[model samples]
Target: MTLPAKAIGAAAFAVAAGLSILAAVWAASAIEGKSLRGVRAALEEGGYTWAEVAVDGLQVTLTGTAPTESLRFRALTAAGAVVDARRIIDAMDVVDPSALGVPEFTLEILRNGDGISLIGLVPSEGAHAAIVERLGDLAGDGQVTDMLETSEHAEPEGWGAAVDFGLRAMEALPRSKISVTASRVAVMAISDSAAEKARIESDLRRRTPQGVTLSLDISAPRPVIAPFTLRFVMDKAGARFDACSANNEKARDRIVAAATKAGMAGKVNCTIGLGVPSPDWAEAVAMGIAATAQLGDAVITYSDADVSLVAASGVAPDLFDRVVGELESNLPEVFSLHAVLTPAEASETRDGGIPEFVAILREDGKVELRGRVPDPLVREAVESFARSRFGSTAVYAATRLDAGLPKGWSIRALAAVDALAHLDSGQVTVRADRVKISGTTSQPDGRDEVARILSDKLGEAQGIEIAISYVPVEVPEVDLPSPEECVEGINAALTRQKIEFEPGSARIAPSASGTLDTIADLLKDCADAPIEVAGHTDSQGSEEMNLNLSRSRAQSVVQALMGRRVLTGNLSAVGYGETLPIAPNDTEDGREQNRRIEFRLLRIAEDGTTVPMALIPGPDTPRPKARPGGSDSAEPAASE
Candidate 1:
């Protein structure tokens, strides 16, 4: 291997240069391998299997279709963690988000006495601002807390319409919650009364946007029963409640249970309401009812903290005394007791010589005040009270001044007049010893109402005899007819002879009474079928006035039918006003046609949904029973 020094040096230099180049290449390859492994491992562990990692020298490259822009950004972040951020190269393609689909947009608006609050995401910032502004206007001095977010996407179909409908509902309902979406709107609200709740629900459903689903959960607060009255009577006609009321469900159940145990059969409707006289109302009522049952042939009335117990003429004196004593002692301290035992035979008057003060209420809402009055001042007061109750023109006073009348004669006369107002037609006879109310009434609780009025107005010790009979609506015994058939028959009758009302009044004209009689006969057989008595008017008056007038006319028809002993339990009175016109209002004949009374069959489901009978599929079916005072919808028939 011996050689010259220059030659050896050149050979060594070449060998050394070649080895250095190989080492340099090997180091670069190792670095690339490490980078590739680290990045690939990082991507896989981060659930980015769609990404493909590559390394060239010191640069790391990500290449593949990412499912989302977020995923693509995530891939770059993962690669950067493994290598220098500056050295990481992003060659990834993001999948089109439009292909995936747009997000769902929703809005929730809540309103209460404290004010209103809005929440959820909207399609645009403009929509968010508009919604907030509308709610703020409605809130007045109340607060409007906005908790909304916006997106840069187009509003979905039906979104704007649904929101607008929901806003309108919110404006009407002070206590409510409205949930809005593209396809549905759900409203939950509280109303002042059952009637008000029905109105709100009907208005909302009627105005719901087309193709959008609407759900309603409207509640009416418990009614405030002034004087908190409850009257239970058990006699030859069996047991019943005149006007039962309780503060809550638990109390109502307890009171009803006591009545049932006291031989009150059938369904007992104990109204759950407010203004309880005492916390132990149920207990007190139960004890009184139980005492009445034990005594046999007795009447019990509770007016606020006052309890009145009257025993029948046949009740044993000893037994009456014992029962009365027990009830009085067992009653809560808040209550005051007044017990009375009738004689074997009720006397006509204190001495059978005092003139009887008679006030008669007729079916036409007229009251005839006759017989006697204590003095001129007493006469004036009695006439004024009668006029106030029975209407100014409806009362006819012809009482002579009598100075020899009893001390409380004026009060008895006033009380008699007041009680007479509860009956459809009745006579109230006030005497020194007793006040007798005898006549027929259309009210289900007419007798009870009269009893309560007299018991409250007169002292508990006052002798009272109520021979008032309920003129029960006669439901003709026949095969049940389908609702549609019933409505068609009614419309057919209307076509032959229309039911005409007095000009600008709800009163059925004297000539129309015969037509009503014929219609009443037809309705007797179809008492259980669901029907809507819709009233429409010509466009001659203000919209609101027309609406009210139409409603009164519709209700008047129902009342007229009731007076004819026809069962109108299934009838619903709805006023379309000028909204539904059968003919052009420009012509007198056309206007006459527009002013109509239509009988439409309503499809009422067990779940309380009301829709037009035509919209319901399948053959028409007979309703199981009568349903009163429900929201209604149906197709109009011939005008009257």
Candidate 2:
């Protein structure tokens, strides 16, 4: 085996290289085994019961579900820290098995640039606090964004300790003295039964807790009265009050007894009537007639007296005196010697041709008269006699007669003027008794004709006086075009413009200039009418952008119209944007058809009708954008 020194050195180097390669392979195998064991142990310790761990060389990969994000992070950190592992890849789901059935309690933990966000629902306030505390500990210096919600459920006991609540309701009224129960309480009172019941119930309910109920019962006493009866009768002939009558005494005794028993004291009335054994019929009749004549309406009999009178309409007061005097003279024996005649009531008499007249009886028993008089001679005589006899006792009772016409009398004149005014221009003023007509018209002959017609129609009415005056009537100038005419004009303009609107956009091609010119002419012709320039867009862009574009387009149209001498103030611009897209935006053709600009007649003063003017395409030429080298082009040049 002995050889030269160079040969030995070369052989030794080859052997050493072979041994170094073998040792490197053995170290790699040991590190791989150690890393696998470390990962497996970490997953098991972190409560990832279903996880599988694998390690290759310096890399550790985890595949499993951890109970919480903290547990997953801890497991990954532990695996990466192993001496053999250079990198770690975690594919673990931090999901709690208990929270699977409770979607509301499930939480998602996300780490953002700013902080950690916790989003989910908790079972209770306690649960939420616990979650926050646990996450706060894990977060350390990081902020936790909590978007958790509370679970709605019945509160546990002891939650209302702040409120002083008692087991039983406080006793208000006594129980035995009154029928008392949970819902209802009853009481007895000798007086003010209703008031006492209400007061007690109110106090009890006010003191009662929020969750309690209440009811009330009361018993009231009845009023006492003394029982009694009375009887009386009317005699065949007559009845009168007599102090010595036995019937009167009996009635008085009964009344006194009843009053004494009922606790009342005062003057008590008692009725009396004649006994049975009637008087002779012939004597009764004669006495009755004599009494009637004396009393001016009274009856007299052997045992009774009654009075009655037959009044005459419009009879003079002197006639009453003569009749009374005659009765006194003829029935001196039956009538009282002091028989008197007095007017029962005074009243005014009303009849045709005679003003309302009132008669009075003087103190010396003479007649007096006052009121309106139909004849001068009669009036003078009545006034002089009344002043001489009654002095200042006479009353004025004159009646006012209405000679004016009724309310509806003016209706006839109104009808006549209305008919005539409809046919021609004129001003008519209606008064209580007459109508005045005057005003001028463009046609003098038409004014005269209207005045004649009104006069003829009103002359027949005797109640209303018609006064006709002819003057100039200023008619308002009717230069405004009708809605139909305006619409027709707008349609004609649209027809001439060959280029129709592209659905909703206001962009018009070069071909539409002629139509736009026609529209300008129509607007100029209908200067009085207010035109609304509306811009509409398809539903392609955002609502806000579309709205702005529409508004800008509408204003552009208004500017163009103004260039043609159309008053800008008369033309208002409105943008409906994509809200009122006449055509659908779903298809390319439909989108192109939805965008348009339209001129609408908003108002017409002649007939107060609003008509849509017409939809006309704007200039279809694309607006030039900035280009390189200062050249005008439709497309914008690319920036450097």
Candidate 3:
């Protein structure tokens, strides 16, 4: 091993150099390990679990898909905090923000007497500016508070239309809250009255843009009533309320329920308003209505705290007294009752010297006037007025001239005649002190009309009694013809007059208009009947050409009928294409017969196939007279 002095020195130096290289490598590996561990720990502690960290030779690299750029940046800062900033490498990627869902854009505009306030997110700054400007213009003297935020997204479909509609609606309703979205606009407002509410709602609905859903919550405040009034009557004509008023919804419902129980029918509109005599107004009204119903024929009127009850002329005295006593006893302390028992013959004068006038209207539309008139001139005027109302031929006047009659005797006679005109069959009696109208009418508000006429003509204080009853007018049902009959009838018309068309063309001739008119008239009564307008062609052309030509002809006929104001919803056009020939196509006459259009009755089978409907035997259905050359095979004529 020990050779020479020079050789030994060289070997020693080489050994020293190899030892130094190994030490440097070990220190570098230790530093890299320490840096990697520190950076990974820092990222984990900072909640950047998505980040991947690696350190190689003093350089730290971070790689991963971070949920956001802020998160990625935070991870890098955290890694830098644990190591040298210069050694850190950012290989991290933030997730694409476009992958996230688009934000919803909405706007709510509230407008009141104070001002307008807008709040919500908009698609862009343009939308925000448009909304602010529109609201500012609407505000006028009031301030517009804009709290709308903008996003840089595109405007959604229907957003502009809905916003414009909402703004228009807001303009219409001064005090309203409008909520606008891409597809809907909701408006909540208050109106001055029920009529105003209805008008506003109708206008808003009519003006709503297409594809935009509209929601409306319009309310009308209760009106103020002075000397609140309610008048209910239960007479021979059934029961009804002449005038109804309540303070609130509950009170109105209670009053309506009482009226309904007392035999009132149909919808009853009870006014809910401000002035009420007492909180127990509904209670008093219910009790009064019940008592009137018990009496059978009575009238009750309420004016503020004063109540009046009047029994009919023929009401049982004992029953009237008992009901009136009960009603008065149970009424609220704030109410006062005035009871009146009409005499049996109160409609007639107590004195025999009071000249009476009467006009009787019969169901046959004839009027008979018999009474006493003031003079000849007055009598002529009365007769002339009666003739004008009841028709010249319908009137028969026979009144004795009386110079000593009352001052308004002519007026009373004329008024009686006028009132008599409204009754289907009834009479009007005019006395010196009262006017009595008794009749049946088809008008639902006949009694009210008569009362109004008397009040307007004679005066409200004049003694007036109405016994008008409403009788619903009955409508007679029409018997429509069966589908087979309808087709047969149409064919019958076609047979008599052939619906001629241009040679080898679908154009209908002008001469065929009369036949079409006849058929159109027949179809009006049975437009709902299913019918097939089948077209046929002779074997003179290709099957396809014949089929298309026949179909066009059939459709042409249907269109012609439609032009004549006939309904074609149930009519279908079908081409036989020379398939179902009634006659041989070899001869001219046979071909003529084969090239005709026929109507077949249609019926849907269980399998959804349309088959020819069977002919129904109907002897009662009148058939038109057949011409000399008309075909009488029960099938309608096929026209070319």
lDDT of 2 at 134: 42
Q: Candidate 1 or 2, higher lDDT?
A: 1
Candidate 2, superposed: residue stretches over 4 Å from native:
1-480, 495-508, 603-640
User: For residues 96-184, what per-residue lDDT tens digits would candidate 2 score against the true structure?
Assistant: 55565533233334443324566655446654564455445445587978887755443233221101111111112222122222233
Residue pairs of candidate 1 with colliding backbone atoms: none
Structural similarity to truth (TM-score) of each candidate: 0.54, 0.20, 0.51
lDDT of 3 by residue, 307-369 (tens): 778787688888888888888899999999988776655343344556788899999999898
Q: Candidate 3: misplaced stretches above 4 Å?
A: 1-354, 605-608, 614-640
What lDDT does the true structure give each of the candidates?
A: 0.81, 0.44, 0.79
Tens-digit lDDT string for candidate 1 (117-168): 9889998876787677667657879999999987768889888778877887
Leading candidate by lDDT: 1
Error of 1 at 533 (Å): 34
